[model samples]
Target: MRQLFGFLLLFATAAPLSAAEIHDDIDADTGWQVITAQAGQTKIRVVPAAGFNVFSIEHAGRELLKTPPALADLPGVSYGVPLLYPSPNRVRNAQFTFDGKTYHFDANDGTNFIHGLVHNVPWTVRRTEVDAHQAVIEAELVFAPGTKHYAAFPLEHTLRVTVTVRPEGVSWKYEVDNTHGKSKVPFGFALHPWILYQGERKNTFLTIPATQWMEAENLLPTGKLVDLEGTPFDARAAKSLEGFVIDDVYSGMQSDHPTVADFRDEGIQLSLDASDDFTHLVVYTPENKNWFCVENQTCSTDAHNLYQQGLKAESHLLVAEPGETLSGTVNYRIRDARGHKFSRWEKAIRKFEAQDRQHPPAAGGTLFVGSSSIRFWDLPKYFPDRPVVNHGFGGSQMIDSLYFADRIVLPYQPRTIVVYAGDNDIAGGQSPETVAKDFQRFARKIHAALPETKIVYIAIKPSLRRWNLYEQMAKANDLIAAFAETDERITYADIATPMLNEQGTPKPELFIKDGLHLSPAGYELWTSVIEPLLPRAN
Candidate 1:
């Protein structure tokens, strides 16, 4: 079932979770520590002592980060995310040979040592700072001389972690300073964030842009890398998260763009972005559990072992020399994707709502609404006599207006709604019939709320550049005009006819240089036709 935590949620910090207010404190135990930061509505909690993990990420009023309600129930299970280093995933027999020295470790995972040793130890808080736009915290955990953790590997080094939260998303940086005078340390760094879900897993969709899968046995790599062809790990695009119980490592990440893994269920969506340095990704879906992990690793599991065995040309181990720093950054963007026809426009919706708050328009007016064409329209200039409220957001689709209707439209209680969308929707791959149906649904919705109010749907005009979709546009306009005829309150404002020339071809004078949007004279022509339908002043 869907759950709501305390009212003090992180929904504001939820999406594009980036910011600049940093706060530092220690856990009640004192052995653990915490750093809380805020950026706009985005709020983030970084627990440095508890493996340098993010304890909470709240936005608006919802906590997007997942955690075990209790930490004591399962041994070695990280309720929060865990920062790992030096052979990240698994080491065979908890041992590896480095420069003739066979270093051994305690097998924490039955026969393998997973997630590294520093994840359980305390990290000293180095610094904390905040600016107007972002908040950052820096902490370090050093491998002390003669300590058991060091003695097992006997490497003198310090691993520093810095996490910055912003209104857009949270970014993390990991830097390892090799203090050894002569020896170059070979190590792996990784993060295991347990992003969980509520309700049905079948409803949720997952996306990870990876190209290869690491062939492993018993969670340990067998020094073989293979393509993701016909395998269950092929998540090149967004697909279902159910049916395939995955605990696998994938490599060959898409370097041209920021590596992203998107998770969406019901109305909520979360996207994880990583630096180009994060070439390897580990997708861990525990058996019969609600939580899943999309981990970013510097190298494949047992990188040191793979490098020692000479099976692969490069094992991705950051062989840092003395006094060198190896670092990376990762960001998390959470959003509520309910209103959008497509999932990716969550940011645009948030921006629109924010814009409304910043510039509150007067209600009970003739509201002009739609995509960019309507957004860029000079509403007041044309309809000077009438009280006008323009709620045209970004390049919005007809469905987008529907999704955000409650917040953008109905609240205003407008006597008339003039819409000019559907141009971009068809370009975005929707059929002409779909756009017309969406308009019909939109009219029905408006009539349901305000039966006396009028709804004027502007016929999609032909653009010289978008002449290819003009046929589809004409078909959609025909359908909308027909539907408008069914209701006395509905009015179809046909602008397409005036824009067509003697040969029924588009007039270049109607559009701007881009041939997509309207020009001043174009609005003049629009005013000439649409002016007749608009209610006149008393």
Candidate 2:
């Protein structure tokens, strides 16, 4: 029954378990189709009549997508997530030749055609669903002869988009069919979402896993790719968007990494995960603007013209033969960092859980948990005959261990648990008293679950690189040592004392060249000090 309950719980959590709501209503004043979907902490508003744009996304009571003040102003406003199709951004000279046919567009921006023809037009709603798992709305645009959209390109096709809202996040699936066209059509697709900042724009950090940037002239791709190394345009890692003035196209997207926007002041992280079909990402951070855009595009800007000019590598233009359909998906995920204290360790915890499921570690064994010191310790090499389970995650704090105790600690039903943390907490500016209290809280939580289980608190080690913080570390160790004396099940080991030389400084042999992490000699010393305190297996 216990095993069955575990499977049921996993099934329930694998998908959204709460009821979702979605409906299509008309605006009395504007007579526009206002579709809304809500599930859990996420709510999305889509205006299908106004180009099927998702204008608003509110999560945890905070607006993540930007919108105009008045719904009437949507025709002129490009703040919402708008679909850019056929062509994205500007096309050279307002025209491109495809299959012996020259297509001409209005020169809306100087000598170039900007955006697309269908972004501000009405779309036909096809489906709306509200269920226990997700809320969804599907809309389509058919471009045929006699329609304004078809007059611009003269090619017939249909574009269907489905937007889904669940507890996890919002997703968009786009399907394009060319059965109505007489010949193959060259096209592109992209989403231009004007991402808003929760607080000051300077406090937000942006990351794009792009290896190279498209070389451009006058905001148009120049058919060249430039390496991003040592360039200001390089945002391969999380970098503050403060004082940045950028409007460029990036390519060579890393298939495994997602683009992330971290609003530090709001404690929110927005990740944009796109399918492999997307080959280019456009990052636009205008000067003095309150909003920015990280667009996911199936092809580069001016792709049709670029491909016509024999610059095929620069333009990832896709050609769909008659009756062919192309599809892709993009997801917008929001993470409330304020609520999940251990969110950064989510992947690590999941990996540990997967390992446990495969091997099924026996209960009443010794469990060691903490930060890098505990993670790097070779328990199997040191205690070869004993039953020990390592659940250490690097760079974790005392509070992190406490926050995830139920998932990683209590589930094991360990007879004894050893902890070695607080090093990072002090380095992160937490008070020594606070660190000691956090460890106390973890101990209390563990004891409450396993009344007879013993706990051993390993003293924070002294390292040459952090010798300046040794005084505060010593204070934190002393406080935790005092608390251990009050409980018979709790034990405090003094590994810090032996790690220091007669001069009261950390021994050079104990640490590597970085002077922080332990060397082989240091782990051996730690093993000698901690092994005796391990409880016997039941």
Instruction: For residues 68-151, write the lDDT of model 2, one tens digit per residue.
Output: 676766753376898988898879999999989999998998999988877888899899888866899999999888888889
Instruction: Report the number of the highest-TM-score candidate.
Output: 2
Q: Over the stretch 1-538, how does candidate 1's per-residue lDDT look in tens digits?
A: 1122221132222122222466555444343445667765467776665666776676543455575454321123366567777778888888888778888898888988777877766678888888867887888877778665677667788888888877666777888787553567788888788776643677667777777788888887776778887887887767677786788888876445444434343345777767777778888876678778888887888888898887543367677888776777776776545434433555655675676566655555688888888878888888888888776766778876764554456656677889989998888777787788678767766665566789999998899988999999999999999988888898999889889999988999988999988999998998888778877754
Model 2 clash tally? 0
Error of 2 at 408 (Å): 29
Q: Which candidate has the top score in lDDT?
A: 2
Backbone clash total for model 1 is 34
Q: What is the C-alpha local distance difference test score of each model?
A: 0.72, 0.83
Ten residues in sequence with the least summed lDDT for candidate 2: 1-10
How well does candidate 1 match the true structure in TM-score terms? 0.60
